[model samples]
Target: MTMLEGVTTRPGGRRPGATRTRVDILAAAQRSFAEHGYVLTTIRGVARAAGVDPALVLQFFGSKDGLFDAALRDDPPVRALVTLAGEGDPSDLGPRLAARYLELWEDPHTGPRMLAVVRAATAAPSASAMVTAFMTDEVMLPLARAIGADQAELRAALTGAYLFGVASARYVLGVAPLAALDREAAVTYVAPVVQHHLTGDLTPP
Candidate 1:
């Protein structure tokens, strides 16, 4: 018998609750990735947490990498960061962006997911690409364009690289002194560099 045999089916012979099932799977994946990080989070574990078959998780997300991308994409912080990059004074963009980025990492609701994404990116090429695209396309590029900056793309790249480095060192690698710094202190240290990237001259001196 086929997998659908003896099972309730919807129109077009599709399984019932397709939307809800996908949502459930994604929610479970988010939790698992947040708690366990990427290397430790398994498709089977997420499927079991969501109360769905392992095949169903694969059918929905295709693989662990896809699930990680979806979970990161679905996260609210991604959109929030994009929005934040364009808000506030252009002059104060550095401190503003740094504060918000650090706040997301410090927040209980968002930190683990951000941590998961960073950790995954280090281990997976696909995850790394997703992060690069998100930081460039979603956040920095638009912000640079909004400021009418010359070499907008380069400026955006510099800004994203700096922020990503700071985040990885503090949150992911737990680098000494940096990781030990409290949020405001971290922001204070980071804001000037971010400001320079956003508004300072890029020409080699």
Candidate 2:
């Protein structure tokens, strides 16, 4: 018998078609979450966007929270931030990190996903906890430790707060001159503050 004749597909097997369908659903979910945030996005809406039955979406991800968790974990900009935290000279880490963080927000492809995560964190407790854990445990803590900073956790937290505040003001709230500033000028203003948070002394006078 030919090789193909001897092989039979088993029931419930993970075929290529099933994998493609899953991927399509995930892409739809990402877009939905990005456009609508966690509180507003729904399994049925994502299913409709993917052109699949709502049951299939539920089958793949179990629940709306599960899908949101997956989307957060799969986010490229977050991954990029984590990767950046480990690279380059500690002295210049501030500007590099600042530039990259801003670039992700500016890029049309990644901007929506980043905006979704931030907005969802503000709107939903579950999303907030997940994002807080990821940012602190995965990205900031390691970077602080890698730089041999004392009070690493506190340093990491401060750095995160500064960056988050900047992003929220400029992108989310569209506040004043900050929102209007060009990328380079914003970076120039932000880099030093980030540098101090990461490496400067924190002891009170």
Candidate 3:
């Protein structure tokens, strides 16, 4: 089965209109946050987009913040990343991690959610905290400790910084050349840096 298959599902066989309305509001909120950004997107705007009352948006999500959190909460990439760290050979972790990271972003099913978090995090403190906490607790530290790296936390932090820089430049900023490169080519260029961070000695040679 596809890695992103279980992240979300179609609202099977048409349930109650209230249930469907909640789903519609959530979908609209995601699109609004992705397109207009968190600050500019409002509950009223989402309600208008979803063809529901602003009160209905609050009825389902409590607040705009709550809706935003719900929209981004089902991140499949994190699960995939943890699994990759656990299942792969230590020596190949850097390259494999880089490849998988790009794969998740490039995929249609997962890419928007990835971008939404990355983009929204820049403009919203709460989003930034959520991303940072996830990276530290769920990804970087775990991977570093799993591989028995020295200064594991530092290595993890640097790794996250490096990966996020690449992602931001290529995917978010639309930087020339980097953004234009194919996924494999980008991985080849960046993987060694990741490998060095993952396994190479950090001390001066």
The candidate that achieves the highest lDDT relative to the unseen native structure: 2
Q: By TM-score, who's the top model here?
A: 1
The candidate, 2 or 3, that scores higher on TM-score is: 2
User: Candidate 3's residue-wise lDDT over 78-191, tens digit each?
Assistant: 556767667868888888999999888898867877787788789888878777777776788888888888999888889988998899999999899999999999999989
- Ten contiguous residues minimizing lDDT sum, candidate 3: 2-11
Estimate the TM-score of every prediction: 0.85, 0.83, 0.74
Q: Which stretches of candidate 1 lie over 4 Å from their true place?
A: 1-16
Task: Give the per-residue lDDT of model 2 (tens digit) for 9-32.
Answer: 233334458788787777777877
* Alpha carbon lDDT at 164, candidate 2: 83
Cα misplacement distance, residue 44 of candidate 2 (Å): 1.0
Positional deviation of 66 in candidate 1, in angstroms? Answer: 1.3
Give the Cα-based TM-score of candidate 2 against the true structure: 0.83
Displacement of the residue 167 alpha carbon in candidate 2, Å: 0.5
